[model samples]
Target chain A: MDGTRDIEALIEMMARLPGLGPRSARRAVLQMIRKRGQLLAPLAEQMSKVAATARECLRCGNVCTSDLCEICLSDKRATGEICVVQDVGDLWAMERGGAFAGRYHVLGGTLSALDDIGPEDLRIPQLVTRVREEGVSEVILALNATVDGQTTAHYIADQLEGQVRLTSLAQGVPIGGELDYLDDGTISAALRARKSI
Target chain B: MDGTRDIEALIEMMARLPGLGPRSARRAVLQMIRKRGQLLAPLAEQMSKVAATARECLRCGNVCTSDLCEICLSDKRATGEICVVQDVGDLWAMERGGAFAGRYHVLGGTLSALDDIGPEDLRIPQLVTRVREEGVSEVILALNATVDGQTTAHYIADQLEGQVRLTSLAQGVPIGGELDYLDDGTISAALRARKSI
Candidate 1:
């Protein structure tokens, strides 16, 4: 209302973003307009490029500019071990750790009873096919520690029970966690997994 | 990144916005991608249009698509009283308040000695010309309550000492403010401006 119709429309659209409300969107739009050459022009160009080139990897569900993502194409990541995650974000997290030398399988989301999500809605069937066809020896479930994540993990494990070896990431306190701050569930899990040093 | 180069670039650009960080930018981009036709495509188009059309009013320093802003062109707002503000944002704030019937003159920014900003850097010269030409009887300095805002207001007041009636927004406790929570300056200002009941 304070600017041109086009500017107002842009602000309205920006306000629909996850983090920005109307007020923040207005501020952002104003800044962009003020610094058009420095920020707005490049951002608009990048967004257009992403809208045109970005696509999901056919094999693993990760986003890529081509048919297959970089990780899916890399021979180094073909360790006959597949790390199954709930989303591409989780797959990236695992990659950032620099420990896993295997490829990834993104489920898109976990099976949720309340949300009416099931195996068919996810990459469960594709995961099964990959395990059998790609000579996968291990299937690591690196899902979140939520209820739906656990249920999906169990479902996947049951499906691949005799077909392939299945495992999941452990649940415990974080690396920089304080003992006093640890929840009862974590404390119990830590105690149960305790080993003599 | 979890996504392609194009998508990563878009997210990086979004992260530079005022309210959004990298994490929130990722979320926003993901949502936009999911609703490409309904949201992302339209938003991109609108941004492009805004980038091309948005301009500042040469007379009042307000954002516009043409030579004059909406307020500057509207005959309904010519109340012979000019509400002076620090920026278009402050002008918008006044409009949202719905108390003023007069038109506005956006100053672009307050006079900042630290930034070496002076009256020439703002619309002070244009404001003087407008007052003389429009037969303006009153000039309201609806500037911010900050030190720079007050300093700018005093400077303007000195320039137009006898040209027109000068006033400012009252400094006092807000409508729903608690006395215990208010600072000493605000409390003192409120006490000094207390009305007879």
Candidate 2:
């Protein structure tokens, strides 16, 4: 118990992470101590490096080491299209899918009237400016299927209406998703948007 | 993506911790980055401190900053009774229970014939020396009920049979455990060890 105080403080800080709790944090700290040279030192070094350098992209709100993110700076990504997302996590998810070859505009959060968050609070204004200034011909709303996500998408659509071809991700039974497990709203939407083969 | 390489490395290291996977690690890293000043920086500082200070207590094999653990140095603990456990985690578990006021002897691990682990591989010789020199009256083998745990317990018992009183933990229905949910082995043990009201 001589050094438990410092270890306990480390556990407490680790417990504040998204997926870790007190018990897991304690185990993690113990393991880190056990592999101090291999894990703890390198992890601490990486965390410090990230804390010192990591910043949001000025253009698209993506996390980056510089003023602009890699995706925002890359000339290979299509300038004609801009995909709108709720946050950096969503942008990463889209990139992992590897379907889209365009630039992304991370809104940082949804429009929540209950929480008093407005369009201006998000990156909506920045998105509109990008659409106009960058000669974007299409704007894709790839926001989540939540109520707040839909509301935010609708607001962005209104902001950029007629200026570009506004589109949204199609809602239906996901590939490999079971019809029996599908929700009523999804079933209804899928039925209404049915296309003939 | 520019800063993601460092972030990904952090995630990989985090995923190596017990009870965490790659997805959870990614989520944790993102949350930490988002709260860099409040969480990431402090966590890094704590980790570095722990890494620099934490070491195994020479006397008890418990993690501590000094040469001996707090419990080993405490005069309040009953040196007459030695509770032998499998590892530091098991010692911590017993400490959490707060039932035994005696000091602990951590064996580190059980004797595994398949793994070529013997008495020399564990702290058995040190435990024997403590029992002889410390004037210990009782030696409690509070080891796990696994085959290897019982094997190690029996081995230790053989070494210290004539010198001190030897005992092991009772095996029966756990507190708040239901008979319907209990295993046959436990039910049989409980019946055999039944006491008179």
Candidate 3:
């Protein structure tokens, strides 16, 4: 690992990913070698491009390649509803289902008192501001079912009570099920059966 | 969605991510708008830097910031054992465990007759060459438990059955469990109990 600190560094970075590690990183590097032309080159190109240009949506906490995320700028998305999630991955998961018609508000993460995470730590204040400024009629809490996540949902609910229609994803999502792990059917079911918190 | 071609182009690109759709891409774009400094700017900067330098390892099939991967160049890793895997993600998973003190060979993909994928379609030929030249003593087939994976492993066994010790991860892994999903303990357990193929 001495000569290729660059590769090691890449692996190290990859290891920090949600489900990767050093050994897996090494194997991945090797596979990238063989498919350099097809997969590796394109992935690297995109990764770099994203790394250089990718940014969180200033309005909603989503990742984008631009200054303003498209949903915030689009006139058509003014449906007066905001679906809040814990991470971009959850937002992506919701998108893959293609069931929701309104805009989104990514929380970046949930409130965790143990972690010293609070509303400010997430995007709660920003969400509150958006509800008032953007004329949102509803706020959908699409966060995970984790303890911290529920705490966050409750906090947001308390902050937005009587200001808008407040709801949470229904019972389709199993306990401890991250949005990332839920199937399209489950997400759709949860969204359909959404209940007021 | 139509203002800046470059930005729209970026959303289009992002839409192609594994889980992201056009709608999510749009929402993602909007979020980037609000947090240009805190998230978007930094992500873009990092993407640019990675894009400029990211390359695949010449010796192994891993993605690297240079031609040679750190593991391939490491003297300590030259333990004559080559753990073979089917994807870069799997490699990264193994790496996260922080075990295994050998080199690696990324097959890029498994032999899939249904998809018309064969040994030549993957990095099998290169793997054979590596074994011959690298004086590899053991070959751990860390491929998935799928039929295609087993087929590929068998094919490789035929090619180098007598040349090196052949082993495979034990059958504890779920049938369709991608290495990406397995926790560190399961992966380590599989590695430790790997049986001779």
Name the candidate, 2 or 3, with the larger lDDT value: 2
Candidate 1, residue B30: Cα displacement in angstroms equals: 2.3
TM-score of chain A of each: 0.94, 0.95, 0.81
- Evaluate model 2: give its TM-score: 0.92
Query: What TM-score does model 1 score on chain A?
Result: 0.94
lDDT of 2 at A65: 90
lDDT, candidate 1, at B71? 86
**TM-score per model (chain B):** 0.93, 0.94, 0.82
Error of 3 at A4 (Å): 3.9
Clashing pairs in 1: none
Question: Sorted by lDDT, highest first, which candidate order results?
Answer: 2, 1, 3
Q: What's the TM-score of each model vs. the native?
A: 0.92, 0.92, 0.53
Off by over 4 Å in 2: B114-116
Residue lDDT tens for model 1, A1-197? 44476787888899988788999999999888877777787777777767777778899988787889898899989899999999877876787799999989999999988989989999899999999999999999999988889999999999999998898888777899998998899999989988799
Per-residue lDDT of A130 in model 3 = 93
Q: Candidate 2 chain A: minimum summed lDDT over ten consecutive residues — where? A: A1-10
lDDT at position B76, candidate 2: 92
Which lDDT value does model 2 have at B2? 40
Tens-digit lDDT string for candidate 3 (A110-137): 8887888878879899999999998889
Candidate models: Cα lDDT each:
0.87, 0.89, 0.73
